[model samples]
Target: MGFPSISKFLFGPLVPVLRIEGIITPNTTNSIGNKLRKINTSRTEGLAVVLDSRGGSTGQCQTIRNQLLQFSKDNNIPLYCFAENFATHGAYYILSAGNTIYVNPTSIVGNASEPQADIDFSQFLLKNQIESRIIASNPLVNEYRFNWAIKDSEKDKKFIQEITDRISKLILGDIQVSRGKNLKVNEELLTKEYTGKQAINNGLADQFGTYEAILAEKFPLAKLDHTSLTQFSFISSYQWNSRFGKAIPLFLLLSLFSLKVFIKYTLIIQSYLLVSSQEEGQEKEKKVQH
Candidate 1:
């Protein structure tokens, strides 16, 4: 849900490391605001911040960018980007907040700027819905058909293009200013989003390496907090440990029943084999006597 433990101790004569993740937006800022506040003063050789997210609201992106930029300048510590996966959108901008950006070659640093706008627009719609409810409750606009449609063709087109241009510029500027940006991406104004190979060719990511290389280069003693989907747990196991702390009995009963059935079937098979062998031995003795 959030970054683990505002700090981690590292190798090399007591170093400090930090990590960040998720969509970079207002909540992202809120989530880390306390952590950031607590980190007003810390002297260290370098600071490493890792990000793994698809990005979030632009406003949030701007807030985080400004906040981290100030932190880096004020504290005089080098900030780095450890790209674990697709560091897309606002996440990419956060990576730019660092002094150096590192990427795992196979890992993706995606370009999904359009999605960020979609999120902001979703928020705008929610706001409008609330306002519409207020208007319905109010004495105004209930008596007339509100002309929400835009009849101005030229104005609408101009407005649309202006917003498009603004979003494009925001995305372009973020990429251009990234710490790992070796050079400007070709393609005028980035008409299309780039992926791993294209991103590298376009200079979005500086260089790629294995996990070991990346950690050693940036966070020599960085311990990745990772999760795997392969872990399996039986339903009855939950009751035995009571992770929920409720100590439910029904699940445990079902588990024991299943085990008992298995044991019974196994015993039956063993008895059947033993009886068949004894009967065969008697038949052979009768044949020998005859």
Candidate 2:
């Protein structure tokens, strides 16, 4: 109360910064969705998303991108994206939602591709004496589970490739639309990987700088309050586990020791009470005899 809380008075309007680090799985997207609901855009000038992910679930990536787009549009606020370390493929998809994308100088940028199967492993299976015969009523469903099926069936390969192409296109489309004249969209650009500097030159990124510095420069009037910003701290299982898991064993041992001490003291008190009662009984008997 003495200084009137600097954040509320000095900063003016705060900008919400969200950090999306590590793998973006279905669970990760759900966590993001929960956090997004908590963000009150009315109190903030703009939203800053700091992305640092290699790549993850394609479907979840699309969901996160769509959600971010909706949040920005609804709030009528600028959504700035800064790649902390790197943002590639699925991560890039989310980054594309930003009005301006920034990356650190050394951060790796793009690598929008899918996994490919190596040569057949039937011989290896035979060598290992492994027998696995997957059966499904539907051909597509069966082929979906069979890794080696792609080698034999052109249709299966095409089917897998088509989905990969679609996911890549989604990333490209967002980047192209967001960056507009800055980005040069092409087949090579979509397939090839780029360094942070290369990404900036190619228009994949608007600038190369830290998220904090960019926010200070871009939104001069806005204050960056990390406490008010949306945090994924609540969603991490490891943090909770590490916090409480370490203490559980120690707590159990202490509890056992305490219980043992309690039992020992109780027995000692019981023994003393029994001896006292016997002495009282002996004294009463002597008086009766007298």
Candidate 3:
């Protein structure tokens, strides 16, 4: 048996609960990836992800989804997802990676549509009397400027449409693959937002339940290790010690340098004020004597 297997055999089973909150970004992916890599899979009964995000970065969403799916497969552990408040856009994309998705009765699910590309700030800038300038080596780059008018750019429209199509394909493909025969709705219906009850009915989610209750029912014996995978806990334990170990000294040095500069400037200002006060007093005395 492996070291983790031996350890599990000696102790007991553990269920790792990872909470993903806020906007999904590269850092989110990195934090989750690092935690997954460090998990002792042999002892793990299953992996549970608690998602509470409004969604962000489609590319990051796909990357994180792939990582989660791969981790579950490689570890031979069932992956459970619990959507708390909402999981729209890229968050929904990541949510579809779960083997079994659980949601609260009021949870918002789905809305995996293509992002809107046309974001012209020209009107707003013009109203505020702000003249935005774009200076680029390539003229093609100017076409993408927020201040530039994009009313009649057929090429830009076509390019945006192509990108949206690809993004849609990737997101919808993953959802279909993960949900498989359980997914009841068509592609058109999948793009619409639904409540937790509606989600289960449409096969977007498996059950209407909270994280604690679901985990309690599913893995009754396994202890939930929620802190291990949390960003703050992980950083404090691992990153702070190892990653920032050498950098701490440098940080202190820079802080001390800043403090020294501040003190020198303060002394200079105080001396100038004192000299100015003395000069004014002498001038007033000379005027009185005259």
Against the hidden reference, what TM-scores do the models get?
A: 0.52, 0.67, 0.71
Better of 2 and 3 by TM-score: 3
> lDDT per residue, candidate 1, 130-231, as tens digits?
332333555434232222331224554465567666876776666565633374654252434455566567666665654445555554333332221111
Model 2: how far residue 105 lies from native, Å: 1.5
The candidate with the higher lDDT, 1 or 3, is: 3
Model 1: runs farther than 4 Å from truth?
1-18, 110-158, 178-181, 187-191, 209-290
User: lDDT value for candidate 3?
Assistant: 0.81
**Overall local distance difference test of candidate 1:** 0.56
Per-residue lDDT of 46-141 in model 3, one digit per residue for the tens? Answer: 999999887888888889999998998887999999899998888888899988899999999899876754566667777888775556788676
Name the lDDT of candidate 2.
Answer: 0.74
Give lDDT per model, in order: 0.56, 0.74, 0.81
- Local error of candidate 3 at 280, Å? 99
Query: What would the C-alpha RMSD of candidate 1 be, to one decimal place?
Result: 18.7
Model 3 regions lying over 4 Å from their true place: 1-3, 127-130, 135-138, 141-155, 229-290
lDDT of 3 at 80: 93
